[model samples]
Target: MHVPDGFIDAPVSVAAGVVAAGAVAVSLRGARRELGGERAGPIGGERTAPLAGLVAAFVFAVQMLNFPVAAGTSGHLLGGALAAILVGPYTGVLCVSVVLLMQGVLFADGGLTALGVNIVLMGIVTVLVAWGVFRGLTALLPRTRRSVVVASFVAALLSVPASAAAFVLLYALGGVTEVPLGSVLAAMVGVHVLIGIGEALITALTVSAVLAVRPDLVYGARGLAAPLKLRVGGELVDAPAAEPAPAPARSPRRVWIGGLVASLVLAGFVSFYASANPDGLERVASDKGFDKSVEEHHTADSPLADYGVADITNARLSGGLAGVIGVGATVVVGTGVFYAVRRRRTGSGDGAGSTGGGDRDTAGSSA
Candidate 1:
């Protein structure tokens, strides 16, 4: 849920800003490893950085398609689990953070003053929790594609409510209104539970789809399904490891193009059918009487405010154009950020001598 300005006091917001900044800084360093630097070996090393950018744009586009949850309430994809499953957790945090920033600055969907709160809840908390749950479940369950898909669902399902709980904790700390803490917690958790189901389905389906085509690109699915074993004379022995084959040059390119197309279709047209009702957080805030504390977004007059073009007369066209622009902008900005991170990592590794190969191997194995 996008927290508007004035919901939390200035001091708490600034504190959250510091926390968000620190998390982002940590994530950037971690992302250098996840993006695989300039190494050229692992199943998807060269592709991870570009794919991470596409993942961010895709998340931005999908967040526009809010589906109906309970009556008069809607919820959209949070993208943390999906991104973490596809890319890595550190990059997933960056992906959601990019989306939140775009939403706040361009669409005015979330408030500028509350940007830190949104990043903490939707970016850091969701990514960390979902990644933890996904890793735990994947470790416990069978190492199969189905297991990965199942884990993705459960991870996504739990992440939403965890984010809600985090928000509740924040509100308790710096809430501007007088609502009872217990009521707010209960309502936030209850509604987000329903929202989480929708999130799980979206995450599972997307992960499944990607795994079907390019399982190597799925960060969570790596090293899953242990190497086969064979029986020789008497006892069973592990099968000989396959020789490492160079990755095809065009595979990731095709996947990237396909993903971009899907994002365009979803945001440019499909979003028009999204439910018009208030989303889970908005509904919960209204029901609990705390919504009255929300202040108007300072960027309310922007050309793309509220996901619509400022001068377009047709509702459908205006929103669709804005969605397309958002996707384009996010992809451009995200790609630049990720590529820069990757390059920095590459430059550092290059300066460090021959040890770069071992480090690349380690990063690939972990990724």
Candidate 2:
């Protein structure tokens, strides 16, 4: 949920900004490792970086499709679990952060002043909690595709309420209105529970879809299946592993193109059917009488404000065009950031003589 400008006191907002900044810094470092093939598989820096960018754009598009949750309330994908499962936790945090930044600056949906608050809740908190839960569940469950999908669902479901609790804690410290702490917590948590179910379904479905096509690309699904074995005479023995094949050059490109097409379609056309009711946070704020504290967004007059084009007369066409533009912008910016991080990692490896020219060639071809 996006916190508006005046919802939190300036002191608390500034403090949250510091926390958000630290989280992003840490994630950037962590993402380097993940994208560099140190955390998942061999085709990393090249493949994972572009996939992460696509994930960010996909999240941005999906977040626009709000589904009805409860009476007069709707909920959309938070995308932390989906991103973490497909990419990695660090990159997942960055993905959501990118979406939030785009929403605030271009769509004028989230507040610019309270941007830190939104990042803390939707980006950092969601990624950390969801990743933890997913990892824990995967450890306990069978190592299979089904298990990973199950873990994704549970992780996504819990992450939503966890984020809501974080917001409640923040409000307890810096709320601008006189709403009772207990009432606020109850309302936020209760409504968000319904929203969590939707989040769970979306995360599970997306993870499952990706796994069916390209399980190697799914970070959370890595090592889920044991290596192949051979039966020699009467005894079973570990099969002699074949040399690692250089990743096919066009596999990631195919996936990226497919994901981008889906994102464009979802944002440009499917979003028109999204429920018009207030989302979980907005509904909770209104019910608790704290919505009065919200200040108008400074970017209210932006060309793409509120997910609509400024001059388009048709509501559907205006919103559709804005959504397409948002997806395009998010993909470009996200790709640039991830590629920069990937390059930094490669540069460091080169300086240390840790990566050979062959490895670099493989990575480049895969990209």
Candidate 3:
């Protein structure tokens, strides 16, 4: 959930900002390992690094659909579970962080002042808990696609309330106004528990869909699924190994294009039907009387504020344009960040500048 401005005091917000910055720094380094070196396969490009950007755009799209969870409360995709299951944990953190950044700076969904709080709660805590639980369950369960999907479900189910609890803990330390802490905790946890069910369903479904198409690209399923076995005279034997890596079932470019199309459709059109109700956190705040302290966003007047373009009286057109713009922006920015991280893993980044300069000097001397 987006923590608007003034929900947390300046000091606590600043502290959260520092924590967020440190976590992002650590995640970036960690992500390099997950996205490291891929000699182009049939796709003929970096394997998982580019997928990070697609995942971010997909998360941004799905989050626009706020399904109703209760009478007057709706909940959207936190996406931590989905991202972690599809990509590695560190990369998952980066994915969600990118979405948060885009939403804050462009769409004005989350306040810039509370960006750190949102990232800590929605990105870091959720990814940590979801990945941990998913890994634990995967280890104990059978090595099959079913197990991965099951673990995704259970992990997603737990992550939402975990995030809510984290927010409560943060609020306890630096809430802008006094509301009954006990009541706030109970309300947030209770509502988010229901939201978690929806989260689990969405995460499981998406993970299953991806696994069916490209299990190799799925980080969590890398070693979890077993190879095919053949029955040889009543005995099961491992299938023959490939000389090189098994080829992808489909083209990576095709998958990327298909995913992008889906994201665009969902955000641009499906989001129009998303319930116009406060989410779990906002509901809790309003119910608890602490919402009065909530301040207007600095970017409230931005063209994309509240997910609509400025001076655009047509709801559908404005929202659709905004969603399309958001998806495009997220893909560009996320791809740039992931590409930089991936390049750093090549270990040639530090010397590239010097190498280029030397070549230029040599050319000049010859001339």
Please estimate how well model 3 matches the true structure, expressed as its whole-model Cα lDDT: 0.85
Using Cα atoms with residue i matched to residue i, what is each candidate's TM-score against the true structure? 0.93, 0.92, 0.89
Give model 1's TM-score versus the native structure. Answer: 0.93
Per-prediction tally of clashes: 0, 0, 0
Give per-residue CA lDDT, model 3, range 225-250, as digits (tens): 47689999999999997586666545
Query: Model 2: clashing residue pairs?
Result: none
1-367 per-residue lDDT for model 1 (tens digits): 8999989999999999999999999998888777864322254455566788899999999999999988899999889889877888888899999989989999998889999999999999899999999999999998899999999999999999999999999999999998898988998999999999999999999999988998877889887877788999998998999996765644588889999999999999999999999999999999999999999999999999999999899999999999999999999889888888777665566344434554454343433
lDDT of 2 by residue, 213-272 (tens): 888889998877766779999889989888977765335778889999999999999999
**Candidate 3: residue 97 Cα off by (Å):** 0.7
TM-score order of candidates, best first? Answer: 1, 2, 3
The TM-score obtained by model 2 is: 0.92
Off by over 4 Å in 2: 40-44, 227-250, 350-367
Clashing pairs in 3: none
In candidate 3, what residue range of length 10 has the lowest lDDT sum?
358-367
lDDT of each: 0.87, 0.88, 0.85
